[model samples]
Target: MTTSVDHDVSPDSSRRPPTEMVQLKHPGRVIGAVFALLLAFLLFRSFLTNENYEWEVVGEYLFNEQIMLGLGRTLILTAVAMTVGILFGIVLATCRLSENKVISLAAGAYLWFFRGTPLLIQLVFWYNLSALYPHLGISLPFGGPELWGGETNKILDLWFVALLGLSLNESAYMAEIVRGGLLAVPRQQTEAAKALGMSSWLTFRRIVLPQALRVIVPPTGNQVIGMLKHSSLVSVIALPELLYSAQLIYSQSFQTIPLLIVVALWYLLCTTVLSMIQSRIERYYGRGSHPTTPTKKSLRQRLRTRNEEVAK
Candidate 1:
């Protein structure tokens, strides 16, 4: 017997309701988010209701003339000291990497001494350097005739001493940072540059340095922020900086906590701005590498994505 097959199928045979999609429930994540929000709300409420915080005082001195001047001085010190540190650090890093044992040893010695000693002592020592050297000038080695001379205290003023201490201290840290960045570049890149008829200096300046900056800029930015805070140590030498300015105000006003709050707020603001700039620099240098960088998404966008995925 011949079997009969249906030539046409009914639409109902092919059609069925779309599968209901349910998003996976993460109860733990929801709990964690709720806990974090509660904690943040409590902290914020405390800040608003706390009587001793003296938000008014913070607002009053936030843009006070003395505070503004101190802020400017702090910024200047950080800029100049970091500039000197980066330049000297590059030299030190090069010396540390030199083939000559003596050159490398010298760099190592410099790093050891600076990195070993306390920065506070260094600042104090420089401030009191006139005690050791009665006069200051350029002279030949081993007490050779002085080409130029000046009184030590006059030449080594507070500003000069502060800068010297900060720059020297920063250079030691930056040296290691620079050396690490340089080492991050592969050996083959240098070899390839040489094969392409590039001079050693040209290869470093054009090929290695740019690539190394991806490693360098981040730590350097940290060093910059550290330098900004570390600058408060200069207050011991009576150099007027941000923290010192706050101290001066509180000393007279006797509103110690409020003045400190002012300083803390200013620091937070400055550091926040610096952090944004650092992120921008990082993104700029991080282009073209594998494992693409993730972009930030807002909460609303994320929720929308979650809903769409669940619908799918």
Candidate 2:
């Protein structure tokens, strides 16, 4: 009995056969990628080689004084409008979140009307507002004595109207964004702040806002970029912002496609810069909050471990 050694339990019992790995083939995916690259190359070649694009004229007027001026105005309007929108949006979001029914209702009504209406329609209406009210002034509740008055056309000039429409419309959208960010802050965080003897405003300003900014900043940046594009709508009212400026140049020289291309290129450049800034801001606010990404070696190790367990 002591001499009965089992041949099946050899010294190499722990050793396992090597697993052969075969990568999955995806010929369809490779073919599709090649076809797409070829199509893109052709399109890019056409942009350079096509005589109809008038690349020379585009180069000539890309930085024309008038075009630069229009771009400047467009940037200014975007800044001013977004500033007003952010400020007013914060107020609206706060009011909507308020305990008072009347304040919340009023904020809701404002959001409803502005968000429901088309921005273009709002811009046109504001530009032609002198039609509805010839003069604007503050007066008594019962239409008693007019304390002050001014011609509507003079008071609501093109710049003023453009700002009014853009800011108001943008505020409505921003309110929702701000409100959503505020809501993302956990209820427990606020409670903890309250326990630490922080006032409501202080809690929001300190604990809540810093955290909520991580959520708010990304969308707010997108809104800033959108405001740049939306500012072009003011061209309808002859505000002579970027797009309108291009239209003016083209209308005279009959270089419609080239001038339009210049405008598109400028817009693309601006949006690209804004996108980079947005990415930086998001990373700043998101520091220490997001989990670190796994390195390739770590990922491969994890997969190997999983496969070994599955084989066992």
Candidate 3:
């Protein structure tokens, strides 16, 4: 009787369960999606049919040379200012997080002054800086021969002022973002690095920052897009960015809405590109956060290597 024991009654087979696939359907979700699509369709139809948009003029001036030049200036300003801001922001954040009170206070005061003021006000101030300080100079600590001196207006042109205003303001905000990211790094990780005889700076560079990037990237991206739009404020000082160029044209042509639509479309295109870049960066830095997903950078590097080998 005992010899008739079933082989299928083994522990492994007992633990195995039959596979069943589930497909969830919610009528409320379907209805809500349909309603949203209907609303979007109606809104788009209105835009297409509306005469006020002046689509013909928008098409005509979309690729105008003046607009292209202005867009180039906008791109240059965004790149330069963000580069400067991020660099300065690193220093400021380090100061704020340092052990010394004097350094931290200095960084705090800098942030307070810049962040408290509106960006538009800062732009206006920079544009009119000569009114307050007619002369610009660099002097030694003991007041030796001035290293450099010039009239503020001569040196601080509209372009320079725009860069200064954007960079200074952005540095304040970026410093805060950087500080938050640094603070988010776990104490245990730093302790472990120190145990391995790593210097503070080396540990920070190799361990802390690599970990902090997962937190830092989202806000940094937001700052980038914000800086791009903030560059528009320079138009008030006649720096001739995309919006300003459109204004210059529409002032003569009386096609305000059309030119606005054109630039608006361009801005939308730019932000879309930036958003895509932000996603790629986020994915590259997120490999450890999600174990199952793969990174694009490795695949891209492999493909590039293959292409170069083929060329060779």
Candidate 4:
């Protein structure tokens, strides 16, 4: 006698009863969606009808060479600043979570001072730091050659000063963001990792950070967009970033509003792209936290099992 293995063959889908309709309607969602559409339409109409916006001047300088150069500089500044800020933010966050009082307090105090001051003031301070110290250099404790610097302008140009200011200021905010992410993870997961013989650094790198990113990413995306626009503050230091470029053109041509409009449009474009990127990243990480819906094959398997049970 031969033993038979059961085959999970599904009944024909066409023979299955029709699915019941879902009657759980959300009236609030429907009303809110409609209101949002109407508001968007009204704003679009207003923008199209507003003749005082100087459409011609905006069109003329929107892609001017100087404006383009400034846009490039703004992108570069944002990338470098955010990178430095995030790297240092991780360090600060880790230090803050450490057991040592001196290290933790030092990190906390750094965050307090940086976050307490206005970023504009920070930019100005860095720009004028040469006045405070006159020169920047590093020498051996026993006295050796000055490692760097002849003049402040030569050593720290407006570019470096703006980058330094933006980075230091951003670190304060990012540190808090990162710290919150670290704290959000369950302590038991870390304990298990340590029990498994993982080193502190390895556990943080391999496990903690990936889990923390789900919490950290949304705020970090907002920070990235904010950093892009905040680079405009560099215009105050006469750095030829996008805003300064627009200002330069408007001053000579005497068409201020249109140039500003151009600047605003560029900012909107950059932020829109960043927002799209943020959405994709959120969806990718979100998958791990929530159960995924069954696919067609899984549904078939379930149906076959159900049919077998009915036959039995």
As for model 4, its CA RMSD to the true structure in angstroms is 8.3
Ten contiguous residues minimizing lDDT sum, candidate 4: 13-22
User: Which residue window of length 10 is worst by lDDT in model 3?
Assistant: 13-22
Which candidate comes out best when scored by TM-score?
2
Q: What's the true lDDT of residue 279 in model 4?
A: 92
Please write out the lDDT profile of model 2 over residues 129-239, one tens digit for every residue. Answer: 889999999998886999888999999999999999999999999999999999999999999999999999999899999999998999999999999999999999999
Q: What is the Å distance of residue 174 in model 3 from its true position?
A: 0.8
Clashing residue pairs for model 2 = none
The number of clashing residue pairs in model 1 is 0
Clashing residue pairs in all predictions, respectively, total: 0, 0, 0, 0
Roughly what TM-score does model 4 have, to 2 decimal places?
0.80
Per-candidate TM-score against the hidden true structure: 0.84, 0.90, 0.84, 0.80
RMSD each, Å: 4.9, 3.4, 9.0, 8.3
Residue 251 lDDT in candidate 4: 89
Top-scoring candidate (lDDT) = 2
Candidate 4 lDDT at 144 equals 73
Name the runs in model 4 displaced over 4 angstroms.
Answer: 1-42, 142-145, 291-312
lDDT of 1 at 86: 94
Backbone clash pairs for candidate 4 read: none
For candidate 3, the clash count comes to: 0
